[model samples]
Target: MISFSALGCTQINGAEQNAATPIATAQPDLAISGNSTPNTDSPNTDSPNTANANTASPSADPELSTAIFAGGCFWCMEQPFDQLPGVVSTTSGYTGGTVENPTYAEVSGGSTGHVEAMEVRYDPQQVSYEKLLTTFWHNIDPLDNRGQFCDQGSQYRSAIFYDTAEQQALAEASKNEIAEQLDQPIATDILPAARFYDAEDYHQDYYQTHAVRYKVYRFGCGRDQRLSDLWGAEAPSH
Candidate 1:
């Protein structure tokens, strides 16, 4: 069984107590940007000087790159990529669905064929796509196709939606390498990128908007426990 003590904070936070509370920085520091966790636990606000400022802008830089991934909860996926050094931004969104502009309720209800996903925009000059792939594989449990951690259903299933043929090859190579390393069959899908639907505005920077609740949900969901069991000493501590 997975251990509960691995969680950084075992208590439910203020976000669950009041929606109006407006999440400040995540306490006990569970986030990502340069690594898979940010260096600061400051409340998310719009400012040019903020460390993770680019995650808010929808406008793209021709030079930047994009990768879409579904690793269970969109909330959990954002932090790791956000903290990566080369990552320009991470957007919580939906993709690999038949529906257009699917709402969270519709997607969560399993009627929209949509999965909770994140769009990671990065600078290849700072971080290689291969490195990003490595970060992704380690962060998720490729053995679980039914869902990720506590989130159950098709929408929560893990997938790597590649936007380019090169990405597909890289993802497949990464998947094969992981399988060989673990000596087990990998369940993560390597599929063509689909039309991505940006999630609601409020969902952006959710870890910061609802830091307390994010921690509460993460701890209650047994995410870290499972990750520890799977990755052993190498598991990223979310």
Candidate 2:
């Protein structure tokens, strides 16, 4: 396994620290609104432009389905779903909050009542919703009510933002199964999904675009280590 130096991970500079940091002051583009251009500013920061909302791709394919999940940092949440065979796309954003068009800074500050979340678009025929739920469970610490891994605060809490009654039932069932298996109370929430505001362009596909910094942050955050401890062999590969 590849291991990162503690100094390297802990010393991640600038906007690489966490999502709550205020890195941009510009207005963000609305994904559903469809009014923003691509951002090419600091590679590590969350640029206000290039938002993708709850639905990342503008695909009109009727077979595609959408699911939203909050597993602390949205960056870490993307890789797992992206690797799945049927997943069409993933968007890192804010949801289940009262604020509209919230920025990374505002949502991270915990005042917007928003939590950092990922909106997943997938094909049901290719992959089942139960499979997506399983993947979500393996990647996060369901017991951590405060947050996941090193990131804390309500903005980083783990949750399932279900859009349909079927999804709610599945999510609740999954949550109960996990709680019973672990013999512990599961802290992950199952809530109705609200309007999902796409995060800055820079935040999307972050693990791919900013590889080194992403690794450093992931290692420093102790995400994988905690996952291994929580789920053991069931843990998703990092």
lDDT of 1 by residue, 76-118 (tens): 8888888789898888877888766566555666777878888
Clashing pairs in 2: none
Against the hidden reference, what TM-scores do the models get? 0.76, 0.80
Which runs of model 1 end up more than 4 angstroms from their true locations? 1-59
lDDT of 2: 0.75
Error of 1 at 187 (Å): 1.3
lDDT of 2 by residue, 120-202 (tens): 99999999889999999999999998987777789899999887889999999999999998999999999987888888876
Model 1 steric clash pairs: 31-37, 31-38, 32-36, 32-37, 32-38, 32-83, 33-82, 33-83, 33-84, 34-83
TM-score of candidate 1 versus the correct structure, residues matched by position: 0.76
lDDT of 2 at 117: 90
Compared with the true structure, the alpha-carbon lDDT of candidate 1 equals 0.70
| Candidate 2 weakest lDDT stretch, 10 residues | 26-35
TM-score, structure 2 vs. true: 0.80
Model 2 root mean square deviation, Cα atoms: 9.1
Q: Which number leads on lDDT?
A: 2
- The TM-score leader among the candidates is 2
lDDT to native, each model? 0.70, 0.75
